[model samples]
Target: MDAKVMNQILEIAFEKRVSDVHFEVDNPPFFRGRGQLIRSKLPKLKPEDTEFIAKTILEANKRQLDPSLREQDASYSLPNGGRFRVSIFRQKGVIGIVMRVIPPHIGSFEELNLPVVLSEIVKAPNGLILVTGPTGNGKSTTLASMLRYLNENYSYNIITIEDPIEFLFTSSKSCIIQREVGIDTEGFGAALKAALRMDPDVIMVGEMRDPETIDACIKAAETGHLVFSTLHTQSASSTINRLIGNFPPEVQEVMRQRLADMLVAIVSLRLVKDKSGENIIPVVEVMRSTTTIQACIRDGRLDEIEKHIENGVAQYGMQTLDQHLIQLCQQKIIAVDEAKRITRSMDLERKLMFTS
Candidate 1:
């Protein structure tokens, strides 16, 4: 491995506050900062140089490291509080490495500019609260923030299971036990099943990777352990479907009822650059379970679920993505033009602007 080049690249990555660094053949190395991409200081990496850089990352994982050259996915901690989830692979005979910089410190709700209601969610002693979004949409940051909130305010045992374990947290009011996939445990399903026996008061599953893990999370919540998880779905209803759809058709109904019963809330978010083109703002859609909503979830009326979320804002803590986007625009935290683009309901964005 070209140790010098790799060291220089890490230096530049940390200096820029970049959240990720991507290297591939024939392209200039670039990194992500504050949700935006910035060019890397290192010149375009040659095929040979990229291979060396990729190998440097794999060597850090002794057990997972392969001398015969195989794709690997793991997290690494850099000097000065930088952490990354590195995935090394070969694409079209060219070495490629994608490293996502873990935020050095987890932020709180106020620090992340999330809704105050989130604090209420974290305060729950038991139930399932999901914060979900498409990849790179700041779901981890939000989840970290909520977990940090609990870390600071409550005196309880909080456990988290992450694939690569991004965003490290320090003990505060809560004692945290973080287990990473492949490192601390076998996999998501096994870790979740084990967490039940760990006697945890709160459990955070990094992402619901499969049916078994989802089932265990629901069971954990049902058994009086507050649960938090993520799914790669855009909205609340879609998140519900993603969970139920993971199971086979024969038992889907049973799982749906289980999900409906233990589910407490869901936060779906997207991060958009602000008006100044400086930083990103989080646009979220929230669904807090109510009698009517829980009833719809049980009866298979998922299609009509939006009405309750969009129309019952005052009655429940629910807020549509469009609602949050409009508010961001109104506050001038994000540009109206960009906000309109990412918003799910462009029609609603237009309508709300006029009424507000």
Candidate 2:
């Protein structure tokens, strides 16, 4: 398809509020909505169609797809102001694209159906707050909601370092300075280092993608800035291990200590279809770093972390994934089978039975 046709397809996707759109050679466009990938009945795309589509996206960002380049990350804004996070890649030796729709406006915690505990979690004056999940599971949306909350209620300086930034925010009660990784700065590490000197009360790094970025995030938190970032992990315990595991074995202990000191909370999310089978809802596992939990991390007792998360539910707004999945099942928000499918624990059925 040509640029006009591609834009028309995007306009249709935007109107329908699809989560993502896929364009690939030899296949009709596919749209993902409510956790389902539905193929459009339009004609299948040819190689030139996808190449032209990719070229349109790259040119919009003032970029060109080099012959040797295999993939790219970019953002696009529609004529109506809708935005998308675009991932352009090569598949089967032909250009393929996936565009994730970014809602024109950021939703509030309540509006997004996030747990009320997030309001309490974001109150921490300084420390690292991580929102972890597999890709496409609302981590960015959750972070954006938290920042929107801070922007409306608190008068502070907030700096965001992003790769092709999504969800534009206007200055409200807070002064927000958003720096894109390639356009406004060299990278996350450099931007984060500069952020510390910019007098920011809160800093949001789009993703902790590397050792330097991760280290910078922790240092920012340790120095009393509220930092937010994401990881492609499923749980709090795993998130900790992933961070520490990134370092050499000799220095893992030091990394663990740093994380224990600066980590404020871990909000893990999984989206599942609601009971109605038409909409998707998030099952959240929130682990606030209490003294006991901090000790678990510092002492390398990763196995005990989930138990403490389960125990801290009532007092500290903490909950394990299974616990929240059980709650969702109990409340009839999601089917029992869906809960069972999402939780990795062997005893999920047993726990649901006993808890119910």
Candidate 3:
């Protein structure tokens, strides 16, 4: 109910490796780990308790809670420097809060169990790199790792436009500047436009939320700046369609050409419980741009993109979701049923029948 109790709750979450913590008016705080939400044994929260917790978060960020404010996005830090991406919203006329844990240190591809192909994907000198997935699937963390790789290896100027700025990066070989949406800049679109003029060699936009931001990303890539952003799509094909679909019908052709020219890679993520049923690992679908794939996008052959991606596994380090899931099952890292539950392929089970 008080600030110390709230901090204690977050500290406990950090110690337990919880991914998210939820607070609501009539329920005990819930902690999500390994894709399961477990209700705590603590007493259910009251209206004033939730409100006070929300107020404490707002004040920590030097902001006041407005009476008419129905939603808020912010970040909170513990005395030990643990960070959380905080979301506060009104539900049924009462306040509810959810805090997603941001890892204190960025993990490498091996540490996160991400495909080493991601190390290769981020090697592109200049183009758009998109990491797409449904929410809570570790999109942000993957991007952070890529940036970490760049920071340690390259001496480029990097700027990030984030909604609340999740990970705190200290420049290594590269000089880094991070801008938060409301506190540092107006929005993603405006910040992206300004990033282009700041002599940046690499720019990381937190998310492509609208047409203006998406267009800015494409243009930034076209002009030889490495761009990184995230989307909520499930696969490479849908990620392309969603980008081109954001524009008007008359201008979509132009948008497709721009995207085809600027795309470097698309990495889609799905988190499933590993064989031990104790840890979560990413099943990645990687689509690296090639001549054939670019032509498919340029000529509106979206359906054919997946086949090309699957076929490029040997040559270009590309793989479809089904391919990764099958590999996971083959290695006994994940169960076949777990793969089937997350896969979109119709014949995946049949293919697994042969392989498993």
Identify the leading candidate in terms of lDDT.
3
TM-score per model over all chains: 0.94, 0.98, 0.98
Clashing pairs in 1: none
> Which runs of model 3 end up more than 4 angstroms from their true locations?
none
* Overall lDDT per candidate, in order of appearance: 0.82, 0.92, 0.94
lDDT of 2 by residue, 1-356 (tens): 67778899999999999999999888999999888899999999999998988888888887887888698888988888889999999987999999999998799888889989999999899999999999999999999999999999999899999987988999999999998876789899999999999999999999999888999999999999999999999999999999998889999999999999999999999999988999888889999999999999999999999999889978988888898888888898899888888888989889988998
lDDT of 3 by residue, 28-69 (tens): 999998889999998999999999999999898888988787
Please, what are the lDDT tens digits per residue for candidate 1 over residues 122-158?
Answer: 7776889999999888899999898888888889888
Model 1, TM vs. native = 0.94
The candidate scoring highest on TM-score is 3
Deviation from truth (RMSD, Å), model 1 = 1.9
The TM-score obtained by model 2 is: 0.98
List runs of model 1 lying over 4 Å from the truth: 34-36, 67-71
RMSD over all Cα atoms, model 3:
0.9
Pairs in steric clash, model 2? none
